[model samples]
Target: MLFKREFKRNLRSLIIWSIIIAGIILLYLSIFPSMAKEQANMDNLMNAVPSGMQKAFGMDRLSLGTLLGFYGIEIHLMTTLLGSIFAALLASGIVAKEQNEKTAEFLLALPISRQTIIAQKGAAVAANVALFNLVIVAASLIGFQFSSAQTLSYKAFFLLELAVFMMHLTFAAVAFLFSAVARRTRSIVSMSLGLVFIMYFLSVVAGISDKLSWLKYVSPFKYADAAQILTEQSFRPLYAVVMAVVIIGCFFAAYGYYRNKDIVV
Candidate 1:
């Protein structure tokens, strides 16, 4: 019942986010043909771009001529950015909103346990994230069908999608922890978004200079690198393990904190 309630409560948000992600995928992918037509000129233009900027944007690692390359270079970052925001928004509000709205007391008076509440809300957030990514994947495949570029390796593309989903999961878990422990919900979304952008910038900066490359270790974006996935055609098991640890650790922390938190309402 709790799971169903949470899922239903977030159904509208799920639909809206799915549309936004799918639309972005379609819009960006529609331009691939035009870009591919002027591939030589585009390559030359990219070549003239500063090395730091190229690395920061991953332009240095991908060829613009191929569909998969173009998607990796142009669309992957945007997907990850938007997906992270969506995950954060969902997670930051799920539990904190009840407290902020003074309804947590009413809910707490019921027979339900805090752990069950967290588990149900976590399931809802996970389901929404999964749906959002599934929609994007479908939209991307449809967009690819419309383009004249050569076929992409399904394995590489699926791996990239998995990486993106894992990145979203990481952000969601962090945001969930914040929501569980926060005294007030007013700044949860802002804080989560800020952290995400900070991590993203760290990854970009690390890419621009070898001296700062160590920063990538702290950035979830680095673990989901589309360029590496495209080039290697494989996911990094070590990074996957790290991401899983972070997710599980944050969730457990949230559960522990929330279980002992006092409800003021």
Candidate 2:
């Protein structure tokens, strides 16, 4: 019952985010043909760009003229950012809202344990993230169909999406941990967004110089890098394992914290 309620409560927001992300994908992809028309000029312009800038933006690894390459270089970052925000916002609010709204007492009066509550809420958040990614995948396929460039390997595309989903799951788990431990809900979004952007910046910095390359190990975006996925047509199994470990660790930590937390009315 709690799972159903949480799912219904978040359904509207999930739909809205899905629409916004899909729209962004469509908008950028629609421009691909026009961009491809000036591919030579754009290539020249990009070649003239500083090598560091090219590396930072993935312009050095992908051809902006090709459909898959264009998507990797242009659309991937937007989708990843927006998706992370959506996951963080949802995960951060799921548990903290009850405390912030002074409804935890009423919820605790229910027959369910806190563990069940967290599990249900976490499942809802995961379902929403999965749904959002599914929509984006469909939107991307449609966009590719309409564009003039030839379609790349669908296997590679799906692998890229899987990596992105893993990254989103990690962020959601982190937000869930924050929500479980937070005394107040007011700063949840701010904190989550700050963390996401910080990691993103670190990933970009890591790409710009070898000295900072170690930063990639800490950034989820590095594991989900579309440029690398596009170039290799596959993702590193080790990175995926690391992401899974992070997700499991965060989730267990959240459950442990929330289970022992005092519900102050």
Candidate 3:
């Protein structure tokens, strides 16, 4: 019942977000054909760009001439940032809103256990994020079909998609932990957005600065960098392990904290 309610409540927003993201994907990809025609000009232009900016944005590794290169550098950025924001916002509000909106009293008055509530809500979050990714995958395929003449590397494409999903899961898990411990939902949205962008900033700064390169290990974005993924054609096992650890640790910590938390009605 709780799972259904939460899923249904967020359904409209999910559809809207999916459409907006898909549209953006199509729109950006549509421009790729024209951009590819100007390949030499694009390369020369990129050559003039500061090396730091190129490194920060992965332009150094990806070219605008090829489909995968363009998608990896351009489309990948929008998808990861937007998808992370969506996941973070959705997860951050799911648990705390019960108390912040004064719904917890009625919810707790029912026979369900807190464990059940958390499980149901977590399921809903997973379902929503998964469904969103489904749309993204389809849209991306269609975009690739219409935007380029070259054959894309299916292995790299799917791997990048997997990375996007994993990135979403990481942010969702962290934001879920935040939701479980937070007292009010008032600042959750801002906090979630700030967290996502801060991690992104760290990733960019890490690439730009030799001294702070280690910061990439701490940023979730580095776990599945588009340039790194495209070049390696596989996910790094070490980064994959780190992301898994973070996800598991955050969920466990959230469950432990919420189970004993004193919710003020």
Candidate 4:
């Protein structure tokens, strides 16, 4: 049962995304060295950076020398975008797919318990996310190989990615909760995307509006600051732990909600 379902998921968007992320990783790593060296000019880069870009990108402490440092600055926003989108998309689809494809009865007819079925699908989502980050790890290692330090900082880098991993899972769990509780599949996906975007916008607005500084805490982006990871080699552990807790809590809530949900399909 696991083989059939997981393989099906693997063949579908999950695997396709894995391949896309792998391609991104390979492509990024290939050019990382040159990019790092090019970014070594801190003064010029900072001085020449537009005020709007600096405000938007948070380019204050970004020195373009070391591979990790350089890429951290350049790719922080990219990571935030990719990580959150994966979470929202995966969560939006996980349960809704069963309904959208009219496979709910086919799946529920299985001998497995409701709990088990939900658990299996959750595992599949986790597996997909793990694969994506593993590719990132491989890419980071390749980048590390060419650093002027000419050495790897495996622990710090992995820990940074681990923070990213947690944020994605949190997003996924929130999305799954929306999927489980919503009345319609398309609505679930729309709401999931809306939720992710709302948080992102809040973060962005918080950056610009001092009156809304509190909005930053409302975003998972606040919890996983790429800039912090770049300079400090770590993120706030409290936020990470809290996000993980929220993810787990939401997952069980989703499971409980879905177990009782009545569907026409």
Residue 198 displacement in candidate 4 (angstroms): 2.2
How do these models rank on TM-score, best leading?
2, 3, 1, 4
lDDT of 2: 0.90
Cα RMSD of all models vs. native, in order, equals: 1.2, 1.1, 1.2, 2.5
- Please provide, for model 3 over 86-125, each residue's C-alpha lDDT reduced to its tens digit, 9 standing for 90 to 100: 9998999999999888999998887998888887888899
Report how far residue 222 has shifted in candidate 4, in Å. 2.0
Clashing pairs in 1: none
Ranking by lDDT: 2, 3, 1, 4
Question: What's the C-alpha lDDT at position 6 in model 4?
Answer: 60
lDDT of 2 by residue, 1-265 (tens): 9989999999999989989999999999888889998999989988998998788778999999888888988899988988998999989888999978888888899999989988888888888889999999999998987774476889889999999999999999999889988977769878988899998999999989989989989999999988889889999998999999989999999889889998787
The TM-scores of all predictions, comma-separated, are 0.96, 0.97, 0.97, 0.87
Candidate 3, position 209, lDDT: 95
The true-versus-predicted C-alpha distance at residue 106 of model 1, in Å, is 2.3
Q: Against the unseen true structure, what C-alpha lDDT does each candidate score?
A: 0.89, 0.90, 0.89, 0.71
Q: Write the per-residue lDDT of candidate 4 for residues 84-193, one digit (tens) a residue.
A: 78768876777777878888888888888878877777777777767666766675566455444545465667777888888788888888788777757788878888
lDDT of 1: 0.89
Model 2: how far residue 262 lies from native, Å: 0.9
| Model 4, global lDDT | 0.71
Error of 2 at 102 (Å): 1.5
